[model samples]
Target: MPGHGSNTESMETASAIVSLITASVAIWKTIDAAICSIKNAPARIQHWRAINRLLQTSLSRMEETMKRRKGAGLSISERKHYESIREHLQCFKDDLEDLQHKIASVALPRRFGKRTIPRQVLTALEIKLQEDPHLEKRVDRNIQLFQLSVALLSLLDPAPRTSVRPILTELHALHLQVSDDDDKLRKWKESAHDIAKDAAMREIGFTSSATDRVRVGRQPSINIQPTPQRDFGIDENFNKEELLHKIKVTQDLATRLEEAGMPTIASNFQLDAIKCGEQLREMHDHPLDMAEYVSLEERYILILISCQSYEEASFQIALNRLNDLASKVDDTSRNELFRERQTIGTLYAKLQDINSAIHFLRIALFDGYLKQQDLLAYDAEIRQTSRLLYEVYECSGMWPDLEVTKKRVRDEFGEDPVASSVEISKALGWCEKKGFTVSERDRQLYFNPLTNENGRTSLHEAALDPKMDMDVLRYLMLPEYYSLRDDSGDTALLLAADRSNYNVVEMLLTIPYLVHVRDRIRRQTPLHRCKDKRTLDLLIEAATRRNSIPPGTDWEPVDINSADCSQRTALHLACQQGRVDLVETLVAHNANVNATCLTGETPLVLACWAADTAKPALEAIVRELVSHGATWEQKFPVRRDPRKRLKARGFSNSDISELTRQPGSSTESSEVEKDASILMHLDS
Candidate 1:
């Protein structure tokens, strides 16, 4: 008792597993002792017995799993969890044992070979428990912890071997019933008409009617009321989460049973859950708001999906009912019908029923409007709907439809990336949460190479966005994606560097040797394409940390001075067109500034050609490269003076024959040396 709840942190997982089982057996024996000691055990006695047995059985199921999991080796967090459970169970064992000892001390007259505890002893104990609110709360908390521990038995196992869910539901109902029984017993004990009033007959071994007495001959029965089924009914303003949670709970059971190879038994449970949703639907006969209507219908739709993978009958029934309900409301309730279309269409899309998705989305967007031709008439929701539908189209390779959605939002809705980012928030998750469960098949869409123009994964595209967190990226990674190039000849990292997206460059560099992954045409490494010094440093640092390339990958780790096919390194790209800060950072990191490209141009030659064309920062960039030990002197350097032996034509540009990509490749205006350059001319 002195160390009632102490030293749990010192306990190990194996010790916890042993101690928990010991404490569980102790608690069971204590409950049984308490049950045996009652002279005229109340109706609540059987409830306590049920709960005690349930806990014992639940603990037994957990024991094997806990041992197996422990054998598999516990993580630090797992060890701590079991230790805490051990400490709690030990404390619960102490509490129940204390109560049992108190009951045991109450010596009463012997009856049927057992010493009974008087009703007054239990009454006093109950009163003591009542005086301390925390004690009762402690018991409930222990039960909940036990519930959670049993729940853990199913941790990675496909099915839970334990019936903890339905058992807990029954335990909860029984607890309330027992609590009410206690209140009744307490009330009666306070009255003059309790066991104390019937004490004279106790000498002759007469038992109280508080329990069902076994008679010598026939059982007495009058008309009996049949027990009622589980009440799944609702009152006004019912808890939506509670009612709807039935879908998850029942489906959970069915899934477990199926996992246990009892699919025939499992199949009925989803149908049972759908039937409950139908009951919930019936209860919502009164008028409802749009959010409520959407919420209920969404749950109902999920119920249909759960019942049968694509049970056409249920879908048609819900569709007809919704249409009938819409008709009853008005010829046109735009908000209602639009949301219904969005909800159902999203389900079809998520279900990968592309044709149905496109059809319903068209109805949601254009059907209600008289001017269906004009996208300007549609609202922001239509834009959201269009985006969702476009994903479906894109998934199915329906390029024309995807283009139409994109064009509609852009041309009519004024969906500029910069402007529309602020205007469009994500649609409420009525649909997002409803689809795409994780499986290898579902993951195939993500990890598989897309057959379309961008060729499938937009991960390359996502990497270019400054805001995207590429850390969760490994979940979407496949071996092919490691070197996968988009249609534009960019690996995800190449795109990051091209854009000078510093954060994305930093993230991509974390993949060993992936920092060196190059684009197809320029064969330019990320280091080659990058313009900023921070990106340069990131790539250089990443190069040193390379490991053995992942198995099955032909990717070779690159040197810090590695060049693209044109033989230009990151330093070469930096000197000519890069900012003064970019040149300074590359130099500080010990970049090889004297390195020449395939065109025989040094960093100093390019810098000189780029400098003092009365160019302000250009002269500074040229000076920075030379100052960083770039010997364009070939030990002596010259400026825009073309009279030098080397004509240095490409110096104004990146010396393209030995070129690493300069920052702007796509746009000619941004490309500094887009035109064919004249050889540096000598003048008299």
Candidate 2:
């Protein structure tokens, strides 16, 4: 009897196994036919086909196993899997039917305007397919059409809406529908809740551009940003090639992470991302922008700062660090290299902290760097800093402060006013690069009320400051301002040339009319105020070129020998100041070697008369002058013993000379005799 009973159970289990395998095959055939009918689907629909194909593989594997084991009594696991499969097939029976019916319409003739079906059911099927092996355990055999709809809707939402909201809505609807008594409703609703949010988020991952509205979820584990491009704005201050390289490396890491499965960018890509992040942090802390490697360390310590807040914390931190830097330099000097302070200040301005921006701007204007700079190179620190300062003030409606900032610029350019009281920065140059234009507000702020409270024009204010932002200057600069001199009789060229602003000098020299523009005091020309050798060379070269002046126009190049009010020529000033380079440059350019000042001192004599402290430079200038045919022969007496008359002529004797006599032979004696003869004649 026991053997017979066991045999009956075995037969029944075999029948059940065969029936489950048949049911799985039947549904898989339905899905396979639907997939075959849908031809050349769009990417969105193709995934539906792919999931169905994978499902067919799972079903085929199951059927083949059942066939091999047909008539064998079911093992514990096998019976469980057999029941699970039967339940899974029953749960999705309607979904498979719906897909089978809809897919033929998708495959309809093109002439019939090709029909389509909803992808929600396909997506839900795909989601369940990915969770295989355990599918039977979780498959709710009594799943209703509404439960399928809820799950399909969750997976369909590209934004996924929110993980909690949709799940809550489904749960609430299920609660009202079942009165909390329907266990199958409860069972399937829990199952939907488990997979819906995650499934929706995964759907979003497939669409990286989707907003990923899963509010409480982690940062979308996928990169949604499109590839970085090379198009850059003026805001980029770092090396562009390096920036691009950094971005590319980052992108490569993201690609690797995505290629592997990820919770965080998986496997080696996670490592790469971590290392890259570490490298970025290291770079953020210590920027290494060395070309030759000689100036590597400490070059870019504070050039950039990242801020999360717009309030004073960041600004204050930056300033304190800057002060710490200055303290390292000197406990009391209270200065950083201008580039450092300017970066922090510019960042403050970007963050819209006006006062902090102004404060940093003020701190950045250390007289050390600016005092040494004449004509700045393109993109010089001072130029950028000043531009930022002007923008900050103007944007903040601090016109008075903006105007006051124009004075801070005054500190940047100072050549010697020892010979003339003209402010070097106030005398600036402006011409244009071809086809450049500035807005009207830029013109007013940069170039505006014609003249300041002092008689200096907007052009004067523009001169040293643009630092060679030539495009705007091209628009702002016009011929009217060329001849407009301030009360001090300074032209922009005179200012630029005076500052030895090479770029300004080079640009201003482009306009033929500006080469010889002179200042009122001492009647000195740009040539007279030019203290830099390169600038002097440029001026001399420009003077030699033909002035595009019309044949009858009174335009004439200022004579290389034109004298100032002191009767001092450019060469005379060069020699007098013991500027060996300037004197060499001038002499080489054919400046009159024997040009005399109001006191009748020749270039050789003036050079020889340079202070004993300037003995070496004086010797060099004397040699340069003499080599260019300067003579010691003085036709006039020592006009009031030059040194004695210096103090009375608004000159400082201490600054000019500590007179020293030189030992000489007969040639010098004869010169002394002539000097005595002139003195005797003056006495008579």
Best by TM-score: 2
* Candidate 2 TM-score, true structure as reference: 0.30
| Model 2 misplaced regions, further than 4 Å | 1-448, 452-454, 466-468, 548-556, 634-636, 639-684
lDDT of 2: 0.47
Query: Using alpha carbons, what is the TM-score of model 1?
Result: 0.29
Which consecutive 10 residues in model 1 have the weakest lDDT in total? Answer: 675-684
- Local accuracy by lDDT, each model: 0.49, 0.47
Query: 139-203 in candidate 2: lDDT tens per residue?
Result: 22222222233223333333432232223333433344443354544444444444433343354
Q: Which ten residues in a row have the lowest lDDT in candidate 2?
A: 658-667
With a 3 Å backbone cut-off (N, CA, C), the pairs that clash in candidate 2 are 375-501, 427-495, 428-463, 428-492, 522-565
TM per candidate comes to 0.29, 0.30
Judge candidate 2 at residue 15 and give its lDDT: 57
